[model samples]
Target: MDIKKHKIINRYYHKNCISCKSWLPATEESFYSVKKNKDGLHSYCKACVLKKAKESMLKNYDKQLERMRERNLLPGMKKAKKKYNSSLKKKKTQQIWQEKNKLKLKNYRLQRDAHKKHNITDVQWQKCKDYFNNKCAYCGLKIEDHKILFKGTYIQ
Candidate 1:
């Protein structure tokens, strides 16, 4: 708004904005800058120029979308959705960090499952169960005898 602050970035006598063309004489007070163009001069108020730029940018939405598609992504397919369906997504995504150890989820469960099929006699299981569950020394949860190392009696 100060009359003296309006110095042209480029030495082109910036008058008023072309859109509004607010004839801001060099001596008048204004905040808008005078942008020089190849055509000679660009008229239009600074406010209009900014508004036009925003509109121009908004119009490029489809162009931006196309650019994204050109870079490995298929048209209309969102990268977020693609990641969500991928195996890597589960581990690599922010939703749930994949274990640094990797595809080793449930390894212990699988081992225990296999062991259940091949080892442990009923009596041995009872003994083990009885031993493991003498009750948490402090919590006092009755330990129901569960299977120990599976392996029916063989060579002693």
Candidate 2:
């Protein structure tokens, strides 16, 4: 209706984006809020800001990765490293225990083999061990001595 009223309405309701040079509604949805700006809205529209940010991230992707690695802030890197270290420690401990209990492990394997192959129960295997005084039948070597002599070897 009135020219001054129309001008005032357009001035307050619409804004031109500095980056895109497009007119958008002067609202929080169209532009980010900026306390420093007189109109309390960013100069660039939301789309322009997002585009610039994406371009910047793509351009500096490697730099960001290096920075994150340096700061130990890369996602999953720390977790993976920790998991690997713990697993390595666990493996080392298991190897040490296996080394210390070599005789026990050999006896367990013999019993398991006897049960699976000959259908011998644990009590029968124990009786057999007692009959031979826990010595190898062919070699006449004690279980402890056999374990040391034939370390890492599987006997049937």
Best TM-score goes to which candidate? 2
- Local lDDT at 48 for model 1: 66
lDDT of 1 by residue, 1-156 (tens): 323323354564435454664655443243343456432333455456556765654456466446655564443457655755685655656335435534554676677888888677988866765775654333232333111111121122
Residue ranges of candidate 1 with Cα displaced over 4 Å: 1-14, 25-41, 68-156
For model 2, what is the error of residue 15's alpha carbon versus the real structure, in angstroms, after optimal superposition?
Answer: 0.8
Task: Give the whole-model CA lDDT for all candidates, comma-separated.
Answer: 0.48, 0.71
Per-residue error at 153 for model 2, in Å? 43
Q: For candidate 1, what is the lDDT?
A: 0.48
lDDT of 2 by residue, 13-68 (tens): 77778787777777899899999977788889988987786566456666756776
